[model samples]
Target: MKKSNEASCHNRVSQQGIKVQLEIIKTEARGWGVRSLNSIPSGSFICAYAGELLEEKEAERRTSNDEYLFDIGNKYSDGSLWGGLSNVMPDAPSSSCGVVEDGGFTIDAVEYGNVGRFVNHSCSPNLYAQNVLYDHEDKRMPHIMLFAAENIPPLQELTYHYNYVIDQVYDSSSNIKKKSCFCGSSECTGRLY
Candidate 1:
């Protein structure tokens, strides 16, 4: 598009049904890219941020103020829960929708190995996370939804800003403003300045 930092974006696709897979490819200026496995339509819930559940207090305690939403208890190449979501819930995948604690909420873990974790960071991302209603009338599990921020094409790796939009929510916990632009998105501020 505008051509700012275009390295971080890639293609992704679902191999068979809802199980979308991530692949590494290349962009025009960006080298070594991973894109979508198929042509994903807009407004589609690409996949859940599946992982282990933990209480907010525990997550905060575990993360030691890392500022990451999900407490992965371990780090993956994809950047999943390295710790836990401090303000979220703590429990197993309960009915896909249940409170992990009073006033505390549960978060998806990459323990189940969801592809969404590897989506990576982008100042301008194609996908965005949406907290949709977790319906369990049919015994369905509650889950956070990932929607296309824009129309994603086939072979494009689905991506979202990993900073969690702390700036958008006015969250002062992020070090992004101080971090460098490895995402190389079109909107890469060059530096956090």
Candidate 2:
């Protein structure tokens, strides 16, 4: 797999399963990454993307440097685009389908988050996000979850697709947003967004 600015990717085991843990590993060339301390089976729960949940307008009021915002407001065609990664991530867990509709909340974890924040982005990923509403019936604020898309070996770095659509996002300078993607998958798009 190719390398990304981040060394690992965030994952989840359950909505309230913060105890489900993995280890953070540092790579001299890749910085810090998340890795399984042991073997993980396919379709297993990893960890939830964790953070501060925000309303649509409130999230919009923040800066455009959306590196850690998870849009719990929209629906996607598949689990691939689940949670609509804005820039960064948070916590959730378990199996649920790809998506449904949400009220208008965004999860921001830049400062407030868990180990799940350590997970990285990949053009090709071993993890998948599923929106689950186990915590409350709000539906607007369902837990954004991650699960193993495939069985992972011990010490393997966890990764998931960021699902960014080229040219749709802009930076604070109003310029087209672009972050070099080093996640070495053959499907790598070269740019993060």
Candidate 3:
């Protein structure tokens, strides 16, 4: 029974891979973005955010800029956090913040990553990130899967909310600096944060 289940899982993964064909393209606003070569149905698996997996401490030390790091932490029912290779209960819920007990593990894609690296951020996005655990029970290192949140047309740029907390900075005059949002959505908040 275990073997049969494993085979079934493998087959499903293979099928998903066949349906996903994406390309990186230069955008007018965002520097680079990933686009679907074919129409993608809602709830379909797009691809995994592949990169170098690092521990919470190591990830923090290496992350000079927050450009390519993806937090994959899990939160237990008790509200405890675990990150990066740490064993987590199978029933634990995945946290969007990726906060761990100490720090948080991150997938650094700046040096090496798949097409997922080119996926730009939007306040209103057609894609959404999902924490999927397969081939392992560790939630701290679960696969960051991208899924189409709605039906996507061919050649449409695939985007998701980065959910980055915008930090307020003050100039010499003590005025707040606002970061501009280029998402171009009707519901754009005018700020990337």
User: Which residue pairs in candidate 3 have backbone atoms (N, alpha carbon, C) closer than 3 angstroms, thus clashing?
Assistant: none
**Residue 146 displacement in candidate 3 (angstroms):** 0.3
Candidate 2, residue 175: CA error in Å? 3.1
Kindly list the per-residue Cα lDDT of model 3 for residues 57-173, writing each as its tens digit: 786566455577786654533232222112213443454343335444689898889888889888888877766666776656777877777889999999987655565533345
Q: Model 3 compared with the native: what TM-score?
A: 0.73
lDDT of 1 by residue, 90-170 (tens): 342323343232334334343444555555656777776644332443212235456665667888766665543333322
Between the candidate structures 1 and 2, which one is better when assessed by TM-score?
A: 2
Span of ten consecutive residues with least summed lDDT in model 1 = 74-83
TM-score between candidate 2 and the true structure: 0.74
**Which residue segments of model 1 deviate by more than 4 Å?**
1-34, 64-68, 71-103, 106-112, 136-142, 163-179, 190-193
Sort by TM-score, best first: 2, 3, 1
The best candidate by TM-score is 2
**TM-scores across all candidates?**
0.52, 0.74, 0.73
